[model samples]
Target: MTSHKRWGLFFFLAPVVLWLFVMIVLPHIDLLVMSFRFENDEGQMQWSLNNYLAFFEEPIYWLTFVRTAIYSILVTFLTFVIALPLAFYITKVVNPKYQGFLLVLLLLPFWVSELVRVYGWMILLRESGVINHFLLKAGILRQPIEMLYRDSTMILGLVYTSMLFMVVPIVSVLDSLDNSLIEAAYDLGANMWTILFKIIIPHASPGIMSGSIVVFMLTLGNYLTPNLMGGKNSLWFTEQIYNQFIASFNWNQGSAFGFLLLVLSSIVVWLGLKLTRQNLKKVVQ
Candidate 1:
């Protein structure tokens, strides 16, 4: 390559390389080092496996970790369930002119900050909030129901927040699908279910996998949604990490929790890829 081209390439790549090193690599290295050290009863910092061991030894910590994993999976599944049909409808049934408008509506909520969105849910679901007030006025219920700070409410918040992430990918894949394939399948005596399962799903697998991975990761790492919506009963692993770092001021334990979350999320993504028989390269594409 000519020197000018090489210089152009270097200029283009330099910012990304610097960003990866500065923002991601350095922080992870610092956290990894911190995870192995702890202040003892004597107030002296020492390197040990105690931070990790404590995770295994403490039932609450391990249980919360497992619970967070399960909840994240559930949220991803729920988001997929909600998004798939909506995506299909938007891409397949809706008029082409109106599709963009519908997608804009889906994205409108996200224009606001996530903290604001979660607070919006709090307002709608709280006993004295809109829903309850409406229901009481209509005599649907004599008393206001306790809605906030529940597991279902927390899951609902997660599903709502992550919906667009799941929908956009499915819509992209579905939009590219040729209508002739469905026509051919029908001509070959394939029913709706067969066409959906044998043709549509297979074509959409990459998008589904991509969307699932993104939504799952986001849901798993989310702190504000669970903490604010589920309150003290959330039992989310991220909450534990927050408590360690901010509340208790235990940086070592927080770093360990953070690493553990990273590991758990990796394993879950790996398992998802294996189960779906998806190529990571294709899914990411």
Candidate 2:
């Protein structure tokens, strides 16, 4: 509260505030403006809603948008299902001495870039990749299976990359849980499932909500893993945006698509928070 401390806080916060405003805020403002405008017949730039209208008018665009949202939600739920048990094991079942080591093991693959990790999957899943090659050599298969470019492969990639985010948050919450609570529930004749459902889940709800939000947003906006793992069959809305901006060089349409995505994803997040009875403050905390 002193002047010197205030100055210190200002110095610490100023750079972050400045960077967000310059790098994130300004560009989004420009994108908003660009999305609402188009060139007229007289070769003049004019404001119009055609960029957004085209999304509803084009089947491919709207369909891809719905597909992306559905797939993102699926990936988020899958990540949670996979992460919850791992988090519980890491927090409650693992030996305290080895817990950090196990955590490190979980983090090891992520030290490398996500592209590298997806490429590792590619190496394992491709037609002549390690898995197929091994099966062929062991006489367990007639020929290499075409495992890549499938929707499952893309979901797998998304889940793998998003796993750490879910796990870390849940682990942080579960680590604080008291063993006495479980013991008390057991003393009252509660079974393992009962304790888990009644005590563990409620205590970890905030972490679960936090992780789900982060994972949902990350997977919704993700471009690399889906594109690489799913290949030409991905049909992700991000690919549509990319095609508009990069391939077709239609910035106006691309910006409209981008804003549409952001808005719809935000609505989904809000609905999730409402359904789960969570709030932004608790999620952040």
Candidate 3:
């Protein structure tokens, strides 16, 4: 309302505005332009949708794109499932004095780079790694088991990397919930299942939704974990994009794939919100 407040707000928002434009807007605009055109033999750029059409026409692209989207969603749901109980135990069951300690434990893994964590898993699961060595020493197995490079392994890596993101949000929302509500529900002859489904889940839905959105996007865009943990057999959409950009040097097709991925991921998030009967604004808040 006043010039002083306006100036203050402007100063506060300036960095974010600049970053969004410079980092997101400009790059995307260029990508969108590149997506629609490519230089032909005559050395002229012509607009076309064949880049997008190729995604459907080619089996590899079609399958990989769908697989990546499905896997990302599945990973998001799995993370939520694991996070719910973990968050509940941390926020509702743990003593307030030890809450920070538990959170610190959760955060400890994240302090190092994600690449490091994946490699840690790789080491633990490799044929001659710690787990196999332990198993062999204890006579639990006849021979070393190869544990790295599989869909389940890749999914495990994704879930491990994403757990904190989901748990933190859920814990944030759950901490605000009053224990008295659960007590009252019990007094009114409500069971644990009823109380959880009727009260706790509804109260925590916004946080769950917010966390899901972040995890989904992160998992969808993630390159390293899937590539390394899932091996060369993992046909992730990002790998396809990387091949187009780096391997084949086809920026136009890469841009098209990138744009399509953005659009589809957005749609999936929108549909999720609609199905859950949650508002994006409320979730964000």
Candidate 4:
């Protein structure tokens, strides 16, 4: 390239390069440094694998990691299930004029902080909350059902929190689907379910993968939802990181845990790309 072209490219890329260094590279370097340090009785740092050793030796830490993985998987699947159907309906069946409004309504929760949303769920799920109150008033239960602070509620919160990410991609992809494809399927006597599974889904694979990856990664790093809804008894990996860094003052273990999560998310992104195996330009068009 010419000198002018090279300078132009550098000018355009400078901000992103600086951002990556400042936000990502710097912290990761710090984590690497901290992960090698060992704290003495005087609260000073030395060098050792004691932090990593403690992490591996504890079964609870491993269990927390597995629990986080399972929760992320479940939330990803649930988000896909809910978002796919809704996206299809909005793109195919809903009026074009109302689609924008409906989508905004679906994503309105973004206006509120996640902490507030979790607390809202808490109110709805609590024994004395609206859900139990309505059930009791209707005589559906003799007593209030225990709805709060469970795996199910945690999963629900995860799904709700990540729903918009799933919906937007699917909607964008489905909106671009050619109507003639479905018409051709129908003229050939393909049933609704057959058309959906065999034709529509294959065409939307890229969007599905994108949405799934986003939801899964977000859920994997999620701390507040699991903490608030799953409560203290629930084993979450991020909580373990928090305990190590804050309570135990073991920055090395926390860094190790964060690195583990980063690896898991990378694997998920790789698998998603492999499964989709479509060019970005084609999907965007």
Candidate 5:
């Protein structure tokens, strides 16, 4: 490469490298240090494992963490199940002329902010809200149902908010597939299920893995949907972190919880890759 081309490449990469180091690496290092320290009875700051120990010692903390992990997994799985068929339909069944329009429809909800979307659900699901009001007027129910502030509602919110992330990846992969492959499989006497499992799935595995990872992480870390939809009944781990930092002013404990969440997400992603036998390099591409 010429000197000018090398300089151009360096300038192109420098901003990203600097941004990652400044925004991600530095803050995480500070948080890691904070997690290990605590104020003692004398009001002296001391380095110790008390913050982490408190998480295991408190039932509420550890139980909520486990619950968050379970809920996040459910959300990811639900998003995958919902997105896959929609993606396939858009990529394969829809007329090419109308595919862009249909995809835009899927994206329309996302044009609004997440806060607005969650509040919209609140309007639909709350007692005396749109659904209940319609049902009551239509003589379908005796009274308004209490639909808000529930686990199912929270999961629905997460899935709705994360749908586009899942669909885009799957559609991108499926769009790249050649129609000849499906025809060849069918010509060899393969049924739909056989072809789906043997051919389509293998080709789309990377996209599936990529979408699952993104959805899982976003759902796990999300605070707004659970807080708004589930109300106080939501025992999400992010709520715990929020309380430690904002409500209780216990930064040490909050830092510990934050790191534990990071660790948990890393472990889950690693296990997913292992089970799927997917290469991270290929999946990201």
Candidate 6:
């Protein structure tokens, strides 16, 4: 390219490039620098591994990390299972008018903030909530059953929030598929189960993989749902990090934990790409 063309390209990209460097790269650099520093006897900052040492020595951090990982995995799996069928039903089976309607419904929750959704769940799961009231009226139970603020409620909230990510991608992919291929499979004595497992799913594997990665990452970073739905017993990894940074004002240790989560998420995303052997360029394009 000519000098003028190069200058023009640079001008077009300058704002976004600068914003990324300032917002992302600078903060990460500051975090890395802070992670190595600790308070001295005089209350001045000094370089050491004390923050990391404390992290490794403490069981709470590791336990919360494991719990977060498990919760994210479960949420991802649940989102996939529910989203796949819904996407398939919408794209392959449902009428076009109704498909659009259902899509609106699927996206309706997004109109409300996630915090609002968590509170909505809180109402339903509480002792005097609609669910328990109905159950009692129907004689299903003698009294209200406790369902909120537990691991199960956290899983439910995670799955509900993350499911839209899974649905949109799978529907996009499935909508592009040739319906005749499925019809042909059925015509050739293939059952619904066989056709789905052997053909339809394989064809949409790229989207499924993409959706899984997105949902896992989102759920892994989630704090509000576990805190609101899980109550005092939640003790999620993100909550721990929040407490360190915001509540206790331990910036160095919080940065270390934040960096740790970043590393772990990167590794998982790498493995996901490896397992699928996906050309991310195709997905992006």
Kindly list the per-residue Cα lDDT of model 4 for residues 1-285, writing each as its tens digit.
Answer: 699999999999999999999999999999988887888899888988777777679888888788788779888999999999999999999989999999999989999999999999999999899999999999998899878888888899999999999999999999889999999999999999999998899988888887887788899988999999999866889899998889988678899888878887887677667666865455444
- True-structure lDDT of candidate 2: 0.95
RMSD for each of the candidates: 1.1, 1.3, 1.4, 2.4, 1.2, 1.7
**lDDT for residue 45 in candidate 1, whole number 0-100:** 94
Predicted structure 5, TM vs. truth: 0.97
- Residue-level lDDT of model 6, residues 44-158, one tens digit each, is 9999999888878999888888878877887898999999999999998898879999999999999999999888988888888989999999999997888887888888888
Model 5 / residue 282 / CA error / Å: 0.4
> What C-alpha lDDT values do all the predictions have?
0.96, 0.95, 0.94, 0.88, 0.95, 0.89
Kindly provide the TM-score of model 4 when superposed on the true structure, using C-alpha atoms.
0.92
Q: Which 10 successive residues of model 1 have the least lDDT summed?
A: 38-47
Candidate 4, superposed: residue stretches over 4 Å from native: 1-4, 40-47, 275-285
lDDT for residue 57 in candidate 3, whole number 0-100: 93
Query: On TM-score, who's better, 4 or 5?
Result: 5
TM-score (all chains, Cα) for each model: 0.97, 0.97, 0.96, 0.92, 0.97, 0.94
Q: What is the overall TM-score of model 3 with all chains considered together?
A: 0.96
In candidate 6, stretches whose alpha carbon ends up further than 4 angstroms from where it belongs are 1-4
Over 95-195, each residue of candidate 1 has an lDDT whose tens digit, in order, gives 89999999999999999999999999999999899999999999999999989999999999999999999999999999999989999999999999999
Error of 1 at 161 (Å): 0.4
- Runs of candidate 3 with Cα error greater than 4 angstroms are none
